[model samples]
Target chain A: MAKIRGSIVVDVERCKGCEVCMVTCPTGTIAMAKEVNHKGYFYAFPANPDLCIGCANCAMVCPDGVITVYKTKI
Target chain B: MTEATGIKEIIKPENLVYKRTKIMTDNVLSYCPGCGHGTAHRILAEIIEEEGIQSQTIGISPVGCSVLLYNFLDIDWQEAAHGRAPALATAIKRLLPDKFVFTYQGDGDLAAIGTAETIHACNRGENILIIFINNGIYGMTGGQMAPTTLVGMKSSTSPYGRDVKLMGNPLKMTEIVATLPGTYYVTRQSVHTAANVKKTKKAMRKAIQYQKLNKGTCFIEIVSNCPSNWKMTPVESNKWMEANMFPFYPLGDLKVPAEETTK
Candidate 1:
């Protein structure tokens, strides 16, 4: 299978650390960052980027619209 | 082939899988950390933008936590009095029959105070869409008991748990409106999970499309969560909603036009 690379951009300040994305990511790629953002909430980040298929499930369920996803086949 | 920087490659139009819809304004949402209102707002905005109805769509919202929806959704909006969104929507749809009109309202504003307007609008068969958010409690009023508060559910006013005999049962407003002859379509949905959000968005899109068809009232009730008001974390609130709200307000279409009922 061709390697599928996925990346996401998190608007940290806009994230409320609700973790809805963490649960929605099908590949289990998302995790809460240890450090809090300016809003004092631990934001979501791609903890296992290699496993991501960029299905955009997290972005679909995100209430804050803080995460943007991109994907490419390498 | 030349190697492309990560930023350069990701910025390409085809590589972008998801981005915030432009229908939403730059203003940050005022909803609490895990409030479902923000998700609902985004779905509506996205649908409007996708359908190319931004120029001709008008939204009306009643007084409640979602009253600030106009601030988040970048479109023409009218603020209606508490529980009067349906009334406002009816007038707007009537005066400007060509425009798409919809009302976004909460349980407190819809089932409780605006019950008359809601029923009358549907009963009259007004060509409009009504987006009802049922979170069980009056989230904006410090989590007071709402008309849709489930039996035995605890709220500020019902801290000891709701008493069915004393306070009455949770009103199934969606089902009630579904029976009206004027309603062309009626369904209940949620946004807790990705699948559910997609389903809700489809429902909203259908409602808007029906509005353009000059069909009667299309009512979509979203069983949402209020993490702050529910005194639960965002995740826990979703779990609680699934366990409680879903049972009382089961999802799926409650009513559909006769012609489309078979499929």
Candidate 2:
């Protein structure tokens, strides 16, 4: 079976809300979420999953060390 | 040979109790617990030793938390007035063009009052390396407001969030420094994690290389953690630096213009 490539899955719990990934993302898919976490910290979420090119921009830009990008092979 | 054990096993020619035979103990470091200054100092000492430039290396210690760096770094160091580390470095490098000179400054010292000196030095293409430590706040003066203080960050002066109306915006020194034509290499890195710590060392090494080779100005801004001032545990502050500050001051090389770097 051929692999299916898909979107970035961020662990919001681990996210420190730093927007490095947002700035580096070429596809402009990720956006800061309106909701605050238990720590009262706002985080970035995949706003346009469809627009995500699986470039690992979010992973590369994330300083919180919480983000991981799993590229689904199409 | 018999197997070595305990202190004997650790005690080797390379593992001498004292620092490099060449390093003078006149200068000592003055940083708080969990500060990244020690790590930076070790890296620099190693560079000076490896290059065998201790005799001619002139280190300029700036004002800020690490103001008393002249005490820690064993080389011949000069104390630069508040926010004038670059200027001091420029003067020494110009007078002794054959010598290796570098400046060590903190965010409060580099981004705040020393802005003009730093910009002018880089713009003039001074052949010096700047080891910039950005801990976000003015750590020396009791965690007061600093130009690099992030928004919503609390400090002695900014008890509330860093208001834009009053404090203005946080300065991204590396980004601004990279834009200068004289800058040969500019990188922004952090020492919050083990891997990043290694990267920071690599950047420092390269910055030193640029200076030793007389390429041009090399600016390495290290995004360090200030646990005492930030009022968080070492581990917590490291986490905070990674999550909140790393994004704003993204790590990686900013400028390495081939023309200048080739020289």
Candidate 3:
């Protein structure tokens, strides 16, 4: 069987932790960090990177354009 | 073997599927954490980049929450007085007929003070595009009641929800602008979700395409959210917008050319 491996990089400092990406993510790959950034806002990070599907939904819905998505086939 | 391939290799430029649009400047956006302005700006930038029209595009910034729009995009910009973006855009488009000119306006600017300019520009079928971001309440002024604010919607001015009897009704500016003979294409869209973002990007590209053809004015109303002014979390604001804003201002095209209306 083949699988599409996916990953995402979140610019922790630039993320506003709005959670739009979290709700919009179909695979629940994103989670908000408990610690806040210097801007005093929680930031989003990938909690289940393995679940990512390279959908890029998070980046599209991100208000800050701080997330980048990547994918490969295995 | 698969485990041997590190993430660095998978994330190389060739493997990268999505990244920030080059049209967006390095400046961090001035919008609130969850506000839709950033997404809308990104979508606009992506369209410009994809169409290779970054050099030919001119944007007019409205005096509102998005006044700093020029800072976000790497395009020539003119800051218009409150509600005068359409008028300014008209002049730019007329002078540079070969370029694609557009105005980014808020509901307060487009529907209230600039109502005449907006209406007249569309009426004249100005060879330009008007991008209207309607978030209902006045987000920049700490949540004042805007012309598009929904009835019974609470704002600083309308402490109690808007009273239609006293404050008049929420204006359907998109619908009003669509009826004008000058407008070639008009649509209402949002950027709350990924699908909506894609749809909005398509609409923006189409508007720009129409401008290249020297078609009449193109109007796009973006139903955005104001999390800070709405006194709700970013996610909550989107939910509230979907529940409340959509009913008063439904999404989809308000007008289109006869050629595109076929079976």
Candidate 4:
């Protein structure tokens, strides 16, 4: 069966660490980082990158529109 | 190099799927982290872009949390006094009948300070869109109780939770406007999740489409959350909104233009 490979670029400084995308992701691919960004907020990162399906759920619900998604078929 | 490095190669321009809409400027939003205003602004920009109305759209921003709305979207904007956005929208639309006019207002500005203007605009059936954001508190002004604040819900003025005996019941603005003969379309929506975001986008698209018909007022009430003022994490605020806000301001269309009945 073919699989989808997904990746995302998070603008760390622009991200306000709302974590809205973390709760909104379907495959549990995102998580908050233990290290804070320059703004002292725990930014979101692709914790389970391989599990990403590139549905764009994180980007869709991100209040700041900071996450950009890329996907390919394998 | 590890296999992970090979996977990173897929992050190329060709595979890009989603990016910020060009309609929005690069300015960082002034809204508190996790506030609904950002998402709402994004959705509004997306709708205007999808309709190819960027050059023709004029947004009337109110004097509350989203007072700086003009800085975010790349469109013509007019800043209105507290609770008077609807009045501005009415005049602008009448003067320029061909342009797409909409007002973005919060609960404190709409349901409270601008109630008279809001009612008359809807009552007269002005051909314009009114985007009302109901967060139930004055988020920008230190969380004072708003007209739409839930009964028994706490605010700075009602620290013990809003008491109906003193503060009065929450205003159902959408329902109130739906009854006006001039309001052709009225719907209540939210942007808390993916499904809801999609639904709201559709609702807005229809409202925009109705604009060309010169129909009555198009009012969309977006029941939103204020995480910073509510003192909860962004995710928690959504859950609280679902439990408390949804019960009072249920999501769905209060009215929609008739398919063949209008033309």
The true-versus-predicted C-alpha distance at residue B228 of model 4, in Å, is: 1.4
Task: Give the chain B TM-score for each candidate.
Answer: 0.96, 0.88, 0.97, 0.96
Model 1 segments beyond 4 Å from truth? B1-11
lDDT scores in order: 0.90, 0.74, 0.92, 0.92
B85-132 in candidate 1: lDDT tens per residue?
999998999999999999999999999999999999999999999999
Alpha-carbon RMSD, each predicted model: 2.0, 13.4, 1.2, 1.7
TM-score of the second chain in candidate 3? 0.97
Task: For candidate 3, give the docking quality class from DockQ.
Answer: high
Selected candidate, larger TM-score, 2 vs 3: 3
Residue-wise lDDT of candidate 3 within B1-263, one digit each (tens)?
Answer: 45336566567777799999999999999989899999999999999999999899999999899999999999999999999998998888888899999999999999999999999999999999999999998988889999999999999999999999999999998999899999999999999999999999999989988998988999999999999999999999999999999988999999988899994
Task: Please report, as a residue range, the 10-residue window in candidate 1 chain B with the lowest summed lDDT.
Answer: B1-10
Predicted candidate 4 versus true structure: per-residue lDDT over A1-74, tens digit per residue: 76788888899999999999999999999999999999898999999888888888898888898999999987
- List DockQ for all candidates: 0.64, 0.02, 0.81, 0.81
How good is the docking of model 4, as DockQ?
0.81
**TM-score per candidate:** 0.96, 0.71, 0.98, 0.96
Top-down lDDT ranking? 3, 4, 1, 2
- What lDDT tens digits, residue by residue, belong to model 2 across residues B1-263? 23223223333443322222234243333455346665566556656777777888899988877777777667788998999999998989999998988999999889989999999999998999998999899888888978999988899888997998888999998899899988889988775444665687678777777777788899999888887789985556777888999888888888975875689
Residue-level lDDT tens digits of model 1 in A1-74: 86777778888899999998898788899999999998799999888766777788888889988888898887
lDDT-best of 1 and 2: 1
Q: Rank the candidates by TM-score, best first.
A: 3, 4, 1, 2
